[model samples]
Target chain A: MKNIFYITILIFIISSCKKDGAVTNPSSVDQTYTPTPYFIQYPFYWSYYPVPIPTNNPLTVEGIALGRKLFYDPILSQNNTMSCATCHNISFGFTDNGKQFSNGLHGEIGKRNAMPIFNLGWYEKYGEINHRFFWDGGVPDIESQVFGPITNPIEMNENLFNVVSKLKSNPEYPSLFKKAFGKDTITSQLLAFAIAQFERTIISYGSKYDKGILSNFANFTQEEKDGMSIYTDIYKGDCWHCHTISSHFFTDFGFHNNGIQQTFSDSGLARITRDPADMGKFKTPSLRNLVFTAPYMHDGRFKTLEEVVEFYNSQAYLGANKDPFITSDKHEAGLNLSDYEKKSLVTFLKTLSDSSFINNPQFSKQ
Target chain B: MIAIKKSWYILMGFCLVILLYSVSCKKDSTNATPAPNPTPSSQKYSLSINITHFFGDSLFKYNTKFINAANDTIKFNKLAYYFSNLKLTKDDGSVYAPETYFLINFDNSSTAIFQIDNIPQGTYNKFSFFVGVDSLHNHSLAQTGALDPGYGMFWSWNVGYIFNRLKGNFGAANTALTLDVGGDANLMKYDLPTSIVLTSNKVVNLKMDIKEYFQNPYAYSLKTDDSSIHDLSAPGISKLVQNSKDMFSVTSVQ
Candidate 1:
């Protein structure tokens, strides 16, 4: 009986000792931790400007993981019912799902269509002019762009200070922040850094067009080939002047007035630059992933790819600040493409879609 | 009984060992702050620039009414500006640049004085500084310290710091007056002559007359002229940038 009593005490002692070890030390919990560096794997064919990662905020495994969680978490919103993924759904090529404008927390409507997010890592210092973010190129870089949606009254509608406090109060976030940034104290700057790191990693380069280019049209359909010719032909589609294919990044990454309207209501790039010459200018969006991202244009005025193709083919307005390419003599009456040609152009755009990018498990919510 | 006591002692010893092992693990996790590199004390001396704001003959304080050369009554509620790339020219023409940026606000007295710890011992006769951030640091989004965007001096939409901001009420009607000056074109540099012998710790006192921003070359009327100037391309911006160069003067050196 005495032996039995001693054995029970020994077991209790061992178990109790394990529990003591599990108790977290408050001081040690706040200690500085070095995070592992995360290197992005660019495709061998892609030769562009180096990714504009800020020297102060390098990509790290822990930082990216924390950012992914923040991107998906609704804790950033005022009502905690919306997240960045609410508007930038990964399955929709990181765009709003077939919506003209995204819906905010209080059922408020956004002014512009949510631009799809991809290939943004390459949009930097394209030439003499630095490539900027947003439809109007208002924000200078991706890191600065994170501040816009969070504070905009029609978007997430959350104050930055409140967002920081909310994240700090969460039971799980403090530790995650400590692991990522080496400090438990969360600031808006660090939050921007973390989210920006995750965004730079959301790359897309596995489209059918990419494959066809590599094979020298070996796998391309005859219709797709004809569409490509029309897209490049200045007298036909005339789209390649701005959305150049040779650069791999379809958009010129410059602001231009595409002549969507004769009299400007939005005042696009002019609002940022305060130059009347820049009136009605908007960013030239990438032609990639047309299948997933629809309801096109800055305002999402066109619902289908057919409408977008038709608008550019003949309906582009001849406005005061319209790009000279559209106002040139050859495009005086527009491309005036036939039904078959229009269909071919749309077909060629669809070839740029990459299903593998949307289905990539790394980009999906955990 | 003796055997049972022996086993009890062994179990206690094991429990103690586990406790100590857990403590050591905790100690290993606690990161030590790295020590700063030591510099030779004899070769360098600390220098502090003390700035004081004035409205004409009186001390400048926020929300206090003051008359300008335009003869308009102005009460400033907010006044903040940036100073960067500060360099001191020794009597021999050699320059000693401390390489720092400062954002000073009239509301915050603590920020009015900035110190340079490692100024090589010499006799400095002239000093110069730019009124705005350089083009490179102005455009770079990732910044910390005084240049951090959280300070509310940065324009998030345009991605540049507001070089100087003066917001207040003017005229009898209390009309709103705001002048947020920024842009690479308007970054003005001022070279002021001063005499100082730096062998040890020294303080250089400087005075910035708020009225100087309204006159000297151009007279700005708050009632008739543009009361709000946020854009760099505004008509009266060049006048304001021109007037900023004459605002600062060395009052004393000790």
Candidate 2:
């Protein structure tokens, strides 16, 4: 009887002590686990500026692979019918295939054109300000821009909470997330980080322009040579003002009202900024991949390079917020390029097309 | 042998009683109020702030009708805001700044109360916090916790946090009204006078009067003023932000 009593007392004491110790000891997160880092290779001309990989979310091979899988997965949509690739197809320079505006779920037509995706990592900054994303230049970074399409009512039309839950329940995704983010706990922030990492890798630098620069015009035809001269000539094409080619990315990454419309129907940047002075202003898109990314401008008004060149030649609306470069003393009315000059300019613009980037199997929906 | 056995039984009984008493004491300590006696300054305690919302003199309830200072009948569908960078001023002029960010939504009862732990025992007289995120974190990359974009407080298209959002309907026609106030320039800081004697664990009760947001320094009339305000440069946004700075007040400290 005495032994039984003592044993009971000892067991009670030991259990209580153990419970108290468990409660007091702080729970720890494993901080030693570090994933393998993946470095991006840039063209030699782009070395002047450092790549803006966020310190908190460094790129990894596992992360980029997981991001690629998520980009192609239809589970992110409401009815599991649409994915990022629905609008951003790889064959079309990561843009909707010859469509003016992308079609969303429920056959809803979007108000703006789907911008192409390429060389986004180099768009880290413009002048002193951090680079903005989307046609309106509203979002500050690519990571933040990921949330827009997924939650947009006309786009994916799905809740972020639902997407997280769906990803968590997937058998293959949990392990993939664990390998990339160090834990299986899926979060919207990590989702954005992964997608942004993959987007930063879809670079386009193997075009004829790039090759010609390296070889000092050895590969250029006579027509392409004259086209290049007219493209860079200050008094002729004058396209270098906003669509700067010297930077090699072929864009100044600035917002300007290029006189696309006379009346403020969509109100472009003014819708986000709420300033009338910024009325009708849209982001200056890069001039690369002109062959694949057709139906140009913010609203995708022009269908072909001939139409785009003709619009700039004679149909500039000359609105109040029209960029001074278009209304400058050199060509106040328009570029007024002749038929031969227009055809040559079109041929030269095609030199910016990189077939290797469009056909890269790594960017496909594997 | 009998006497030794009796003494052993007494000692064992005494130890069992001590064990039970100590366990009960540990449980009671968590539920108890602030200790009356002064504790050592080296010891740390947690400070909890319970936020109770109000509309004028009554407790604020969502989807309920209430008359505003403008005499317009209003019914709120949503009310959410962020509290960030909580700082406490000690009696010696020193500041105890806790890196805290909380997204308080009227629909979520769990987010109504937040605790600031690991605070050194001291007499604090002032409390200050920002109604919006700092410019550094606002424009920075993706974030988690309360600042996460998943919370719906963030403006993903514009790349900023909507500091405060009050969506509702008003008037005879039941017109929709959305007031999403956000911007780096409009981050309002409130420095409220407080008398908190923190010897042990303490809970400070704060009352947020929703009616004060429409009145106080600026009298906002839903009938006359622009009912929808999503842009940062909207006409009455500065007035609304100025009015919101005076909404929170410490009702009691325990």
Candidate 3:
């Protein structure tokens, strides 16, 4: 069995190299290509359940490397002007630097804020609904969601078939694809798989919060500790309902009708579900990188974390479709937090910032 | 060294054959018991769906004058919709549930026909079809072909497919409506449990009476002059739910 596997690998390498024009003679490319399997090392906080890997898109070093390259490559765009990195720069924790709505090709602004792509494999599936990506959760898994920005009129605006044609004709993409997927062909499915595989590896487990909570290695200051208590405590800040303390991925991945607006210009989750009740609802975003991914909300309505806290403290709108967690919080009167409590909460939210993730050499655009 | 390599090759080839065989064993949907007597099995039959659009008693044509129950004149160049969750039941209480979804434009030739193949030859009664994409598939994943977002059947902002798109002209003015009827499964489900039968050498024909949408329970009137809702949100969504039931009819089985 081992011999056969080795022989198959040898054949795959030789054929792929010949197809890629890397080798003129078959004998020159006969060495077997055995890829190092990449396993997702789960954070100690998530010790209960194992990280799930799709059988068809299992992570390998080659695939992750390819995805990282595709992520930063402008070739995926229509006019070669914008890449995934064009909006989600590594320095901003894979988000646009404080941009409300990201600027796409042709200087057109997008409707929703660019969500930081990290710890996506940890997205808690909301009951039967899979709100995999984006603000409205229109696309399901990462495999399907990857096509959205590329084709949106105000976004990248590139056609899917045209993008495939461009990648197929590209000089280097074919060989890179072969190394990642064990073939020289480039399809939309393979392209999405490569990108999604890379995204799953963008885990932010080395945060100060993680170290303090899991290993007891890092100690938080008094303000941060008070903030942490407010964030987790049900009686106080009431933030843990959407962003849990026990989990490394802060978000519960459920859509919530937060009291953002009384009358919404963006229908939000309701626009996707067509449910009147889902109006002004957006997916509960991860709190892990709140320091970087600002202004907040789907429309980038809030400019600062202080504003976000202030809104929750006093201005949480008592809309009909407001999430029960908030509405039931003394009938949508809000936490009515004191200035000190609000300040502590902001300080606690900052502890989630993982400088290690942003500066990870493996994740940066080379 | 050569002898060792040859033995390894033979063992590896055997393992490969086993792996291939194991894979092929897993994908059996129709598990019909084989006949005890050696005989050539009854050949499986194929089914295809044909949709014809009608405005009231008159067959709908591009730019042709058609009046509704409201006495409002409307002429449409294209009337398109999405339909899925086709289940065909046999006389013996056996059901064949096939995952087939289609987006059809009445004016276009390619979408006018839906070919469903590979069925055990028998008379089938009670064919059911949904007026929109099923709730299970609607939010499950991004899909291609008929359900593909690239087909413009998908909602760009939200996480659902635009189940129906009614575009083109009404009277002298252009009437375009992209009706995205999506909600919780219970609210959005427009299931039509059709009572029809198909026998040998016969194809099932479905006629979509577009005028019936404006009649009776769905008396929602529309004028060509009425601008597109732009955002096809609720209140209008209720109209679409009613339209789904009224639009479909099993015209013929022969």
Best by DockQ: 2
lDDT by residue for model 1 (A1-366), tens: 657655765575555454345556554455456998998877766755566666788999989999889999999998998899999999999999989999888888988999898878677656214338888777777777787788777888888778888998999999988888898588888888888888889888899998987899788888899899899998898788789788767888888998897789888888777789989999889999989998899999999999998888888899789999988988878889999889999899999999999998878898
lDDT of each: 0.83, 0.85, 0.72
Ranking by lDDT: 2, 1, 3
Give per-residue CA lDDT, model 2, range B1-254, as digits (tens). 99999888979776885777577447544546675675487788899999899989988887789988889899998999998999999878998998888999988772389899999888999988988898888874378899887788877677789888899999999999998999888897988899888888999999888898889788889888768987775778878877887789999999
lDDT of 3 by residue, A1-366 (tens): 567776775565444334334444567677677556898886655767566677768899999999999999988888998898989988888888888888878988878888998887756334225555677766667766777787787888887778878998989899989888787577776788888889888888777887887546348899998998888777778888887666556777788888888888887776666678878888888899778778898888899999999888778788678888788846366787888999999999999998988899989987
| Candidate 1 chain A, run of 10 with poorest lDDT | A122-131
Best by TM-score: 2
Q: Over 4 Å off in model 1, which ranges?
A: A1-33, A47-54, A77-82, A101-111, A125-129, A153-162, A183-185, A214-222, A273-277, A319-321, B1-42
- The per-model DockQ list reads 0.19, 0.25, 0.18
Model 3 chain A: worst 10 consecutive residues (lDDT sum): A15-24
Interface RMSD of 2: 6.5
Question: Would you estimate the TM-scores of all the predictions?
Answer: 0.82, 0.87, 0.76
- Can you list the residue pairs that collide in candidate 3? A138-B159
Ranking by TM-score: 2, 1, 3
Best by lDDT: 2
Candidate 3, residue A347: how far the Cα is off, in Å: 3.6
- Which stretch of 10 consecutive residues in model 2 chain B shows the poorest summed lDDT? B24-33
Interface RMSD of each: 7.5, 6.5, 12.8
